[model samples]
Target: MTGPVSTDRASDEALAELLMRWVPQQRWFAHKSSSAHLQRLERTPLDEGGVAQLVALTVRTGLGDEATSTVYAVPLTVRHAPDEALAGALVGHLPDVDGAEAWVYDGPHDPTFTRALLSLVAAEEGAGSPAFGVHGTSADGGLPVPAGASTKVLGGEQSNTSIVVSAPQGSAEAPLIAKVFRVLSAGDNPDVVVQTALAAAGCERVPRPAGWVDGTWTDPSGATAHGHVAHLTEFLAGSQDAWRVATAAVAAGRPFSEEAGELGAATAEVHAVLARALPTEPATPERLAALADGLRARVAWACTAVPQLHEVAEAATARVDAVRHVTGAPDLQRVHGDYHLGQVLRSAERGWVLLDFEGEPLRPLAERSVPDLALRDVAGMLRSFDYAASSGAASSGAGGEGAGAWAAACCEAFLAAYAAGTGVDPREPGSAAAALLAALELDKALYEVVYEVRNRPDWAHIPLGAVRRLTSPPG
Candidate 1:
C-alpha cells in the first residue's frame, strides 16, 4: 500500500543502510551471517517510467581486523501492487522507508522488467543500441543491453542469478536465455563463450545463442576499463531442471528406473554431439602431471579439513598417476565445465538440455574454457546422482539399507541409460574415468565442507557424511 519513491530524491546513505541489512538475509548471499559494510558503487535509473533503480553495491566484510570486499549489482523495482506472481521472488523487505516497497534482484521481475526491459530486448533483436545504462561506467561507454524476444528470471537456482532473454517479441518461435553474470570477476565468462560456440557447431543439446554483451568498466583509478561479461542468450521455457525432478521422485518414493535409463541415454547423445562440436587435443604428459599435482593439492587440503577423505584421496591420486600414460581415444571436446544434475533440464519433448557452461566457480576462467575429456562431464553427472541421493537421505533422516537401495537404484538407471546411449562400457576404460570422477567428487565435497562450514554451519553434516562415504572401504 506504499507509493513509489523517486530515484532522484532517494538518499544514497539511506539506500546503503537498507541494502546492508537486506543482503545478509538473501539465500544467495555467501557471507549471509557475517557483518558487512556497504558502499554505493553506482546507481542507474531504469527507462521503465523511472520507477525502477538499479544500484551496484560493493560490500566489505569485517573478519577480525581485516575487511574483504565483494560487489553486487541489484535492480530494485518500486510498485504499489507489483504482481502477485512476484511475491515468491522477493529477496527481502525494504526498511520502513515511508511509503514504498522495494523488490531487488539482478534484474527486475520475470517476464521482463516492465516495458523498458522489453524495449531493450527489441533493440537487441534489431541489432541496435540498448536503451538501458550499465552501472559503474559512464552511460556513453557501456555496452548496450541486448534486445530479448522474451525474458524471465530462471527460478530455483540457489547459487548465481540467471535471467533468460529471447530475441524480439515473436521474431522466432525459439528464444535465447541471456544469463547475466553475477559475483563479477575478470576475464571472459566460459558459459557465455562455450555455449555460443556449441550452438554454432549445431550442438542441439545446448540452446543456441542469438547474441552476447561484453564490455569494459572503468576501475576505481579510472585508468582502464576491466573486461566483464554482462549477459548472453539462447532461451527456453517450461522446462524443469533435472535435479529438481530427480529429487522429487526420490522423496516421493517413486522408482526412477525408467527416467534414469532415459537420462543416461540422453547424456550419451549429448556427449556425441559435443564430440562433434569441439576440437580434440592430446592429453600430454605435462597436462597429466598438472592434473596430478592439482589432485594432490586438493587431497592435502581435504586431509587437513576432513580426515575421512585421506584414504580416498591417496587412492585417487595413485590411480590418476597410473593412467597418466594409458591413452585411449584422445581427450577432445569443449566440455560442460560444471556439469551436474542441477545444470541440466528435462524437456518433455527434447529429453535433456544442458545449461551453464561456466565451469567450477573456483577455477580460473581460462581453464574452464579450455577443451577437456568428455568423461569429465560424465563423471560430474554421476556425482550429481550421488549428491541427490545423499541430500534426500539427510533431509528425511533415513540411512542404512533404505538409503543405499534408493541410491543404487538411481545409479543403475542412470548408468544403464548412459551406457546404452553412448556405447561406452562403464566397466571397461570408463572405470578409470569413473575413479577419476570419484576423486573429483571428493574434491567437490572438500570444497563443500569449507563452504558449508562458513555459510550454513547447520548443514555442514551433509558434506561431512559424503567425505566419510568417499573414503570408507566398500562394504
Candidate 2:
C-alpha cells in the first residue's frame, strides 16, 4: 500500500474527521470537555513527495453563547506502515487519495517532520508562500545544527509537545529541545521573548536560546495571521528539575532548605533581570484593588468547580480584599505567572535554570503578558512546597504534623532568601506584601483544586489541605 499521493482538499476533509477523534486524546489538547468541530484553516506539504503535511486547524467548540474556538497546528506524516516506535503517536489509519489504507503519525514524534522543523529554524526561513512560513533568531544570532542529530519526544507534558534533539556525534554544542506550542495565537510568545531578553542581558538562570519557528496562514476571515509555533533551547544534558529533587528530599526526610533557598534567590535574580529588561510600574491602590478582584474571581470560579473550596471561600476572599486596602504595595512588573519547583531545572553547570516563561497557558496571552506583582510567583512556590509535603506524607504515611512542619520550614527558608535578594519582605506580619502573598497563595491553591479535581482526583487532597489551613483562624 502506498501513502497519500497528494494532500488535496478532499484528503484534508477526510483527515479532519479523524483528527477530531485524535486531538482530544492528546494531553496537549485544550478543549476536552467541549464538542469540537474542526475547520481546516490551511494544509501545506512540507516535502515535495506530499507524504508529510503541515496542517492548521481552527476548532469551534461548545455551542450557542457558550461557544469557543481555538486554532492549532498539527503536523502529520503519512506512511503505509508506521514504525513500532511511532505506534504510540498514531493518529489513525486513513485511505490515501488512491483509496489505499495509510497510517498517520503526529509530526513532532516523527523524525522527518522534526528534521524539517530543525532545518527551518536553522536556516531562518521566511514565509515565501501562503502555506509556509518561519521566523526566528538565535540568541547570538546564529543557529547551529549538527549533522545526524536525532529527536526523542519527552513525556508527561500537559500543555505543549516537546522533542529533545541530540547533538551530532562528538559535537561540543549542547543538545537542543524544541517545544511545540499546541494552541496557536498570533504575536510573540512570552517564553521566547522573555528568555531571549534574559539571555541577552547575561542572565545565567535560563536555558540559552537556540532559535524558534513561526508560521503564517490566512484565517477564516481572509486576513493573514502569524503565530509562534515552536521554540528551541540548549538542553541541559544531565540536569534534573527541582520538583523531582524536592520530592526525593522529602521522601528521604532530608532538609531541602539549602536548595530551596538557592532556587528562591535564582527566582529573584530572574525577576530583577526582567524588571530591568522590560517595563515596570508602580502599584497604585486602584491596581491593587484590580489584582484583588482577579484573585476573588479565581476563588469564586474554583469554588464553583470544586465545592471543597467552599469551606475556605470567605476567608480566601477576605485575605484577597486586605490587599486592596493596604496603603503601600510593591511595584508591579513582569513576573513568571506560573512559578513552581517543576518550572526549574538544576543543571550541573548552572545551579538553577528557569524554564517555561509561557505562564498559565490556559489564560489569554494578553493577560499572561501583563506585569503583575512579583509576589504572585512567590505565592505559587509557597503553595508548591505544601503540595510536595502533602504528597510525600501520603506516600510515606507520615503524620500531618510532620508534613506541615517540613512545608513551613521550606517556605520560611525560601521566602528569606527571596526577600533578601529582591528586598521585599512578603512574609512580614501586617505588611502589604504579607497580605498580597497570602491572597495569591489562596488563589493558587484554589486553582490547583480545579486542576487536580479534573486531572488527578486523588491528588486533590494535597491542595485542599492547604486551602483548609489558609482559611483556618490563626492560632
Candidate 3:
C-alpha cells in the first residue's frame, strides 16, 4: 500500500502553470486553436481519506475577456510514490505538504480519484471545504462501489471523462458509468435531469438514473456559478448502439422496417413520459414566429454556405412560411435535442435504450433547455437512417438506388409507428404537422450540408439530396 501524500507543495499558482500547458492537449478541451490561460478560482478536496488526496480545482479557462471565459473542473491526485502502472497518468512531480517531493496525476486515470469519486457519489456527498462553497451531491440511486471492483476510463469521448465501475470477474453487481465533466457551466446537465426524471417515472427506454456530482465556484468576476462536475448512471454492459445495428442490417440486405418501427415506438414512449414527468406548455404564437424567424435565417445562410442549396431556396422559403403561418403547433416540451442513432443503445434485455439527453454539446445549456417541437427529434433520427443507408451501401457494394430505397422504407415505417404511438399522424396532406416536419427535416439536412462542406466535402451530396427532396412540393 502507498503512504498518504501531502499537498503542501501544490500551490494554486504552481498548479495553474502546469495545467495551462496540460489542458490544451486533453481530448476534452474545447478550445484547441485559442491559447489557454488558467486562473485558479477554487480548490476543494474531493477525497482526503485515501492514500492519495483527490483535489478538485475549478478554474476559468482561456486568458482574456473574463465574461467569455469558460469554467472547467480539474481534478488532480497527489501520490507519495509514483506507480509504474500509472505511467500514462502522470501530470508532473510536485512536493507534498510535508515538503517531501511527490507525484501528481490526472484524476480519472488514478484509482485514488476514481474510487473516491464513485464512493462519494454513492454516499451522495463529497464534503468539500465550505469556505470554497463547493461540493458534490448524489440523487436517490447514486453509484455503489462494491469490494474488489476496478474502474477503467472509457476513451474516444470528446467532452467528458467516463469511467466504468464493476466487480471482479463473474460478479453480479451491475456495472455503473460515471461521467466527469471537463467543461463547467451554470446549469443542471440535461442528461442527469431528464434521464433521472424519466427513470423515476418508470420509463424503460432510458437507463435507470444513478446520480451526479455538483459544485459551486466563483467566476472571474467574483460571482457564484454552479454546475454538475460529474454524473453517474447505470451502464448496459452488452448493448450496441443503433448505428452499428442498423448499418449491419443494411449491409446484409435485410429490411430494417420492423426494427425501425420498434425504435420509433420506443422514442414515442420516451417522449410521452417526458411530457408527463416534466414541464410542458402550449406553443405560443410568439414562440412559433421566433422559431420560424431562426429557420428563415438558416435557410438564407444555407443557400449562401452551400451553393447547391440555391436550386431549392424557393421551396425552402415556402416551407418556412408554412411554419410561420401555422395554427395550433404541437405543444412545447423538453426533448432529446440531439436525437441520433449514436445517442441510443439496443439492449437484448431492454428493447431500445436512450443515452445522452444533454442535447447538442456545442449549444449553451440555457438554450437547449427551452421547449421545442418533438418533430425536431424526428428529423434528426430520419437523417440518421439516411446516414446508415449510405454507409451500409458503400460497405456492401450496393447501388445508390438500393440505399435510397432502404432509407425511405425506414423513414415511412418509423413515422408510421410514431404516429400510431402518439395518436397523431404527422404526414397528413396539407396539415400544419406535415409542413413543420418537412421544414425541420430540411433544417437538419441544411445544417448537415454546412457541416459536410466544411469537414467532409464529399459527403455534402447526401444532405444536398435530402434538401432537394424535402423542399420539393408534394407530387
Task: Give every collision pair in model 3.
Answer: 6-97, 8-97
lDDT of each: 0.59, 0.81, 0.78
Sorted on TM-score, highest at the top, how do the candidates line up?
Answer: 2, 3, 1
- Clashes (N, CA, C under 3 Å) per candidate: 15, 0, 2
Range of the 10 consecutive residues with the lowest summed lDDT in candidate 3: 1-10
| Best by the TM-score measure | 2
Residues 1-475, candidate 2: write the lDDT tens digits.
1122444677777788888888887788888888888765566655545566677788888899998878887888877765788898788888664255789889888888777777666666543355544554445743475446888999999899889999777887678889989888777788988888888888989888888877787655556778788899988889998888887777778778888898889988999999999988899988888887888898889989988677778888887788789878888888888898889999888899999999999998878788898998999899889888877777777777888888899998899999999888987888888888888888888888898999999888888887887878766
lDDT tens per residue, model 1, 168-225: 7655445545455555555667676666556666667776554444433333333333
Which of the two, 2 or 3, has more TM-score?
A: 2
Which structure among the candidates has the greatest lDDT?
2
- By TM-score, the better pick of 1 and 3 is 3
Evaluate residue 414 in candidate 1 and report its C-alpha lDDT on the 0 to 100 scale: 74
150-186 per-residue lDDT for model 3 (tens digits): 8889888888888887777898777888788777777
User: Which wins on lDDT, candidate 2 or candidate 3?
Assistant: 2
